[model samples]
Target: MASSPTIRYGALAQTFHWLTAVLVVTAFILGPEGSEDEVFRGADLGRQAHETLGLAVFVLTAARLLWRLADRRPDPPDVARWMDIASKAVQGALYLLLCAVPLSAVIGTWLEGHPVTLLAGIEVAPMIAASHSLGERVSELHGLLGDTLIWIAGLHAAAALFHHYFLKDTVLVTMLPRWLKK
Candidate 1:
């Protein structure tokens, strides 16, 4: 099998990175607003889409992690020690949030005695016993985590841009697909 370029991620890694970003933003936009009852009731396309996208993010993250274990990543551009530490911290937080956001949603929905509704008439029934109050709290936590994820991701993008424009480094370019790298 061919290996990735020493200075750039392979196409698969680039694809996963960009696709995850799109899915996260789209899911955030589609998230239903209102009380738990209002969100769970009726046939809401937005809610269904949000749940589906969240699930997709969770699955994609798992796959990306697995791929990373075997894939050789591009070497990091030369930078200050602090910058490297901050970058790793942000990346770790993003991964944690990616997993937590979806899990909280599932746990919250299940605890509230509701099924996780998805597109194409699919539904995942609650596996845990009902605890309406705790469910509400967990659902609220999910919202907070979602917001945090967006903010951290924004910071990550800004850092990449800074490296690209100010530092004149390959930090961002290393992840760009062939078409975008030109």
Candidate 2:
């Protein structure tokens, strides 16, 4: 919360953010294809792991939004207005996708008529679609949104690294895990 170059994230926020990032990267690396394909295209355990972690990402992102609102975030490096706008635009896009991608995914899965099992046997009620075409359409939309999210997140990471090294700023410190850096 301090308007200084200090760790702005609380313990809970940092833990959730880093852990979720790990799971997200793992999921992205694995891709969506499970062992079996063709008729039965279910999440399988690993993909379920991905989707489950996605839901957690949604929650953590929500928490981060709240934390950001509660505390004044430090500014990016002193730069040109256009550069700052670009940085803010990228961050805003990331935040929007972070929230939206999970929502669409959850809705699409439920519409496809499957119980979204969580860490154990916990499941959410199906948000059934009116028709198969409708379900597929929504699912397609979800996939597109997810792909866009990945691209945006890449931009986010690249910008962070640029700021940390080239721009010589403290921008990346808040998000780095404890052991990763001082």
Best model number under TM-score: 1
User: Across residues 1-182, which tens digit of lDDT does each residue of candidate 1 receive?
Assistant: 98655888988989899999999999999998998778988878899999999999999999999999999888898899999999999999999999999999999999999999998759999999999999999999999999999999999999999999999999998889867753
- Model 1, residue 5: C-alpha shift (Å): 6.3
Worst 10 residues of 1 by lDDT: 173-182
| Model 2 agreement with the true structure over 138-167: per-residue lDDT tens digits | 767767887898888788889888878888
Best model per lDDT = 1
Displacement of residue 153 (Cα, Å) in model 2 is 1.2
- Give the TM-scores of the predictions, in the order they appear: 0.96, 0.79
Q: What lDDT does each candidate get?
A: 0.93, 0.69
Question: In model 1, where do residues sit more than 4 Å from their true spots?
Answer: 1-5
RMSD to the true structure for each prediction, in A, is 2.2, 3.5
